[model samples]
Target: MGATGTMNDAWLTLREVRAGDRVAVLSPSWAAPAHYPQVHEQAMDRLRERLGLEPVEFPTTRRTTTPRERAADVNAAFADPSIRAILSTIGGDDQITMTPYLDARPVRADPKPFLGFSDNTNLLSWLAYHRVPAVHGGSTQISIGPGPAPHPLHLDSLRLALSGGDHVLEVPTQISEVGHRWDHPRALTDRPESYPAEPWSWAGPSRAVTGRLWGGCLEILSWVLAVGRFVRPVEEYQGGVLLLETSEELPSPHEVYRMLRLLGERGLLAAFDALVWGRPIVDDERMVPDPVVASRARAAYREQVLRAVAEYHEDMVVVQDVDCGHTLPQHLLPFGEQITVDGVNQRVTAHFRRAPRP
Candidate 1:
C-alpha cells in the first residue's frame, strides 16, 4: 500500500516477524511479570512453544521501573538489530508518563513492529506520531496468558499482522466477557464462559467507507486528549477509521456518552470516515453477577454509543458489537493500515501492507 493521503510523515517500514527471532518484551505501563511470576512464565512458555519465538526481557519487563527507564527499554528494542519485534507484558493506568522520556530519532531510524493495547495506546500514538505503523492489540499477560490457548481469532490476526498479509477480519462465533482472576489458583486452569456472539450492527450510510485504522481504548484516548500529547491536528485524521473500546473498568453508559460528546465537542468525532466500536466486556463479577443485569448493561452501552453517533455524524458509517476490545478472543488491529467497513454488507476488512521483509 502507498502512503495515506490524509497525513504526511516519513513512513517507516515494519518487517514481518520471523520464527526463532528474538522478540524484546517490555512493560511501559504495568509490570505484570514482576508481581505474577508464575503467570508470566506460563505466558512466555506459550509464546515459545506455540509461536516458535524467543522472548528476551528488558529492564522494565519483570518489575516496575521509572518512566524514563521504561522508555529506554523501548528505545533499545527498536534500535537493536537482533530484536525482530517488540511486545508489551500488559497495560496499566499511566503509560503517557513515559512519552516524554522516549527519543523519537532512533525509533524513526529503525522502526520495528510494536504490538500492544490499552494504556499501551500512548506508545502506539507515539509510534504513529513518528509515521510508524504498529499492531494495536495483544499483550502477554491478558491476551495470551489466561486459558489453555490464545483465542483462535486472536492467534490468526496476530499471525497475519506480524507475518505480513492482508486479513479480512471476521466476528468470532463465540465471545468471553469475563476473565479468570490472576491471583486465583484456578485462573490458569479455568476459562471464561463463552456467550452467543452478536453480529455487527451498522449505523448510518449503506455505502462502504475505507481508511487507515486509528484510535484505541477510549479511556486511554481521553488521557491522551487531556495532555494534548502525541496526537496530531484533527485534519490529519480525515480518512481514518476510529477503533474504540472501553476497558474492563466498564464505564457506565452515561460516561460513554460524555466521552464521545467530548470527542464531538473537540471536532474530532466528525473527521473519521467510519467508526468501529468493540463489544464492551461486562467482566466485573461482583458488580453485576446476574446474567440478566449484565445483559441490560451491555444493551445500555450500545444505546449510548448509537446516541453519540447520531449526535456527532449521522452520515458516518459505524459498526458496533465488534470483537476487538477488552473481551476475550481479541483481534489485532493495525494502527495505521487500511480497513474497509462495509455498511451495506455488514462486514469489516483489514488490508495489511504486503511489504517485503527488510
Candidate 2:
C-alpha cells in the first residue's frame, strides 16, 4: 500500500446479517415512492430468510416529510446500543439537507458499518471526513427489492462488504439492460423489466497500485465539492483508488467534462493512481431517447469525459463501464479504505485495512 491516511479516523465492522441482531434501517432523506415499502420488505425478507439477518426499522424509516426527523432517527439509531449497524432504505436526491443536523458523537463512539449509495453520498462523505469507513452501495429498495432474483454481482459485492474479507470485488459482466420502475403497483412484487446482461470489461490499467479508497455517485460527489466539507488534501490521494459513477439523472457528457474539469482546475484530478468510473444509468431520462442517440451519448462519455480527465491526469489509469451507480446489481465500495487497482489485469479490487468477522 502507498501512503495511508491517519488511523485516528477508524472503521467498526459489524457482524454480517444474523438472524437475531437488530440492524437499523432508516430513510436518509426522501421517502421512496409508495410501492417501495413492499420492495423494502422483500429486501428485508431476502436477508432474513436467506442470510438470516434481522431487519430492524426505525420510527422515521418510512416518513416522507421531515429532514430533521430523519436525522433524528439516524441519531437515535446510532445512539441505541441495540443497533449493531445502519442501512439505508434507499437513496434520496436531497439527503444532504437532512444530514446537516446529525450528531457525530455516537457514530464516532461506535463506528459501525453504514451502507447506501446515490444521495446517501452525503452521509458517507461525512463519515469519510470523520475517518469512518462507509460502504457505498446496498440500498434496500433497489438491490434487494423486486428484481427477478438477487443479482449475483450485487450479492457477491454486498456479501464481501458485509462479511468483511481478503477478497477482490469483481464486477458482473452480463447485466440487465432495462431499468426497474418505481411507480407500477405490481413492481412491488419485484417484477422489474429485464435486459441482456452487459458484463464489465476493463479499458486502460497502467499498473498495479493500492491505497485508501474514496468516492461515491458522481452527482452527489459534485454536491460535496460544492458544499465544501473537510475534503482530504490532494496529496493524501496519490496512488490511491478513486471511485466514481453517475446517477439516474444521467448527466450529459458536457456536464461530466465540466465536473472533471473543475476537479482538475482545483488540482484534484491529478491525485489518484487509478480511477473506476461506473456506467451511467440510461433507463430513466435516457430510456425514451433513441438508442442511436444513447450510443452516441455513451461514446461521448468514453471519448469526451474519460479522455478529458485522462488529459489532465496524464499518468492516471482509468477504468470505465464498471457495474455501479444506479445500474443493476450494484456493488458497495468502502470509502476511506484500501483497494487494489490492477491495470495489467483490468480489475479494481477493494480490501479492508481492518475487516469485520462474518
Candidate 3:
C-alpha cells in the first residue's frame, strides 16, 4: 500500500487565538480533573496567567462523567462560537467508546484547536478525518499542571500554534521523565528534576521527507485498529508522518513489536513516509524502578519497535527519542499539518499552519 499522495499541504485552517479568547476544557476520557481537583485548578490558573486564555469548563470537565456526557461536552464546545480551542484534562484508557457519541458536524463547521495525547488520540484522529488540524501532544494534568511552569518548549510550541502562524521547533535540550505523584503535595509547587537529552536517532537514508503528521500512544492506536472505528484506509494516510509513543504502563518490547507488526500486516505501517518515535519511559514504579534497569528497558523497547518497523519499511525514515509523548518538555504538534523530517541533518520541523493553499 503505497502512499496515495502527500497530506503535508492538506492542513485544515482553524480559528486563531486572541487575547481574552475562551478555551473549553473537557474530560473526554478520564475524570482526572474530578479526582484531582487541585491539579486541575492549578492548570486552569496557568492557562489564564501564562497564556492569557480563559479556561471554560464543560459539564463533564470534572465529576464522575460518562462517555456520552463527555462526548456532549466536546460537541457543545465546538458548537459554541465563543470557544476558541478545546483542551483535555488528561488522557484515559477508554476514549474509543466515546467517539460514537460525537457529532462531527459542529466540529467540522467550526474547527478549533483540540489539544491532548494518549487516550485523547481518539479525538485527534476524528478531527483529522474531518480536516480539522489538532494538537496531538500536551495535557492539563501532566505538561500543563504539574510543573511550576510549563516546559519552555511546550509553552513555545503551544504559543506558536495558537498564534495562527508557521513556526519551526527545535528538540528540547533537557527533559524530565520523572515527576511527583499527582496526589503528592509537591505536585503543585514543585518541578521535576531534569536530565540532558540525547540527540534524536535517525534511521534509514540520510534524506528528507515532509508530510502531515498523525498518530499517538501506540497502545491506544492498537485499540483503534481493533475496533475499526477511526482506522481509515491506508491510502488516506499516504506520505504522512506517523507519531508513536508509549505510556507509564510500560508495555514490554514484545508487546511493542506485536502491535507494530500488526500495523505492518495491515499495510498501515507502510503508508507513512516517516515515523517520529516518542521517547519510551521506563520509570514505572511497578516495572523498572531502578534507573539503570529503566534505561536498559527503554533501549529494548526501542530496539523491538525499530525491528518491527524495519521489517515493513526498509527505506522509511525514522526519528527516535523525540520529546513528544509521555515525557516532559513535550511539544504540542498539530495533526494533519505539514512537517519536514530532515533525515540528512537529523532535524524535524512541523509547520503548525500551512502556507496559503493554491
Top lDDT model: 1
Which residues of candidate 2, in runs, are more than 4 Å off?
1-19, 33-35, 171-173, 183-191, 197-205, 285-295, 353-358
TM-score-better candidate, 1 vs 2 = 1
Model 3 steric clash total: 0
Instruction: Write the residue-wise lDDT of candidate 2 on 1-358 in tens digits.
Output: 1235542234454344434667887788667734366677777888776556777887777767678888888899888877877888888788888767888888877777788888988998887777678788888777777655577777777767766765565655444434456555665554344444444545554688777777788888888888876476666656667788888777888888888888788777777777788776665743244555555566778776566666787777777777767776676776777777788877778774444434
Task: Name the 10 consecutive residues with the lowest summed lDDT in model 3.
Answer: 1-10
Q: Write the per-residue lDDT of candidate 3 for residues 1-358, one digit (tens) a residue.
A: 1223445434458777876889998889988987888888999999999999999998888877778988989999999988988888888898888999989888877778898999988998877766678888768888788857887888888887776665565667766776778898888888876666666778888889988888888999888878876666787888888999998887888988998999899987899889989988777543215556656776787788789888998888998888888877787777777778889888888777633312
Number of the predicted model whose TM-score against the real structure is largest: 1
Off by over 4 Å in 1: 1-5, 8-10, 286-291
TM-score of model number 1: 0.94
Task: Please report the TM-score between candidate 2 and the true structure.
Answer: 0.88
Pairs clashing within candidate 3: none
Which is the winner by lDDT between candidate 1 and candidate 2?
Answer: 1
Q: Which candidate, 2 or 3, has the higher lDDT? A: 3
* Clash-forming residue pairs, model 1: none
TM-scores, all candidates, are 0.94, 0.88, 0.93
